[model samples]
Target chain A: MKVTVKLFASLRKDRFAVDDFDYQEGATVGHILASLHISEEEAAIIFINGRHGGPDSPLKDGDLLAIFPPVGGG
Target chain B: MESLKEYLLARAENGLIRLSIQAWAVQNFGLTFPAAEETILGLNLLPARYQRNQRSLSCGQQLSLFRSKVAVIGCGGLGGHIVEELARLGVGNITIVDPDTFEEHNLNRQLFSKLDNLGQPKVAVAASRIKEINPAVTIVSVYDAFTSRNGSVLIEKVDVVADALDSIPRRLELAEVCEKSNIPLVHGSVGGWYGQVTTQFPGDYTLQKIYSRYIGERGIEKDLGNLSFVVAMIASIEVSEIVKILLGEGSTLKGKILSLNLLDMEFSEITF
Candidate 1:
């Protein structure tokens, strides 16, 4: 199963902006984050194929997973 | 008063009047500049002072902006720039709330802060700067922090609110107040080279969704610090959202957050 992963804001500092990952069948968003070395706390918002997704949400092949860190300031 | 109206009408050239007519109306009729401008617009006459704005905004839309009132919470990095833009855009009334004084640290990103104003209150400087930018804008500076107790009174008369605050708890509190007041809020935040903006209406739960896990935690901005360009960029976006709301034009980021990363030069929009 091939999934395209995208990271935004500070999440991309030490991580690649976009990458392709081959995961096992029925892999959850949490599993992807763990594999990318991104802590669940660091990924504020996650979207799967442009729809809001949670860590427990499962990702299918050819899905686009987007992760963003909380950019909170004034 | 009838004679003054007649004088203004006589000054009109092809149904378009110059700002001098507004000045005359203000002096003779004892009407404020904005009041005079609105009366002129109501009579289907256009003011020459708004000639530039007429290109992008219709005469009616410009009048709407002149009649709208906005409240900006916090007078630091974001608040300073937002107020500057709003005044230049001719928002009739602006209520600025902040209790902090400008220190040396604020010189980096605050628009109104200067070496001479190091000890001055942020709202006071904002008021002075607004006056210099557009005297037609009436600014009411509240040199107090925006807490739940004072939020209602401060924003009761504003058509919209801009959340320029740096604290998450205060942002959440302001969202609750806007919900009760039924006013739309334009929210923007910046950290280092990154920034995010969104618009929240009553019961949208947008801010809560963004700050869900970090409600009590401080933002990463504390560690990375804010960049001047990022603050200006986010503040400008917040002002644009307010303008759209005032004119009732275009789609707002009501339920979505637009995040920008200057380092990566990437912009992303997420809807929750």
Candidate 2:
């Protein structure tokens, strides 16, 4: 299965902003993060198709996965 | 008491009142600048300082802004710019809260920080700057950190609140307090070339939902540090959100988060 992945903020420092990658069937968000070398700790907010998602949440083909880093600064 | 409308009409230059005249009216009639400005706005006369805001903001809307109150939590990078914009936009009452003082490192992005006032409190500097920018805006500076214990008192009667805090835990706490008070919170945060803004009305749980799994005092900002441009941009967006909430004009970021990547200049809105 393939999923479109989007990264935001510092999460895109060395990574692509939006791209697609192949993952095994029934792959979870955690699997996608691991594949991108993005640690779960650095991924503050994750959304699947614009709604909140978690690491344990499963993804499907053609799904849009977005990840954002924490930006707690004044 | 004299009729301020007649007095303002007499001094009007092309139907626009100057700041000097407004100041004179405030002094002579013992009226607050906001009161005098409101009178000027009531007569369809513009305050020269606010001329740039015309068309975008009508006289009625400007008068409405002069009657609103806002509370800005944290007086650092985002807070300083927020306070400055609110005062210049003629927000009538502003309450600023921060416990930290200026330091040498804060010169990069903190708006109110100056080399000579390194030890001065951030809120104190903000109060002084607000008065200098727009005397019609009243400022209440609190030289203390915002916590759940004192949050209610700090934000009492405020129509809107802006979250410029640096701590994730504190942001969550602030959301809780605003929720209880039934106030709208315009939240903004910046780290390096990235920033995000969202509005959380009562029970929106936008902040709570955003930071649900985050388990840290700070975020990527600790590693990337903040830049001047990103801080100012986010602060301006937050101010716009506050203005919309006050005047009921324009679309706001409520129920959606505007994620800004300044490096790539990409702005994406993610709806929750």
Q: Of the candidates shown, which would achieve the greatest lDDT relative to the real structure?
A: 2
Provide the TM-score of chain A alone for each candidate, in the order shown: 0.95, 0.95
Predictions' DockQ, in order: 0.66, 0.81
lDDT of 1 by residue, B1-272 (tens): 37656877788886677867788789888888777878777777777766677679777777788889999999999999999988887788899999999999998899999999899999998898877667788899999999888899999978999999998889989998998889999999899999999999888988877776564455768779999999999999999999999988999998899998888788878887
Which window of ten consecutive residues has the lowest lDDT sum in model 1 chain A? A36-45
- Model 1 lDDT, residue B64, Cα: 87
Instruction: Give per-model TM-scores.
Output: 0.92, 0.96
Instruction: Give one digit per residue, the lDDT tens place, for model 2 in B1-272.
Output: 55777789998998789988999999888898878887898898889998899869988898888889999999999999999999988888999999999999999999899999999999988888887789889899999999999999999999999999999999999999999999999999988899999999998899987888788899899999999999999999999999999999889988999999989999999998
lDDT for A32 in candidate 2 is 90
The best candidate by TM-score is: 2
Instruction: Name the lDDT of candidate 2.
Output: 0.91
Q: Each model's C-alpha lDDT?
A: 0.87, 0.91
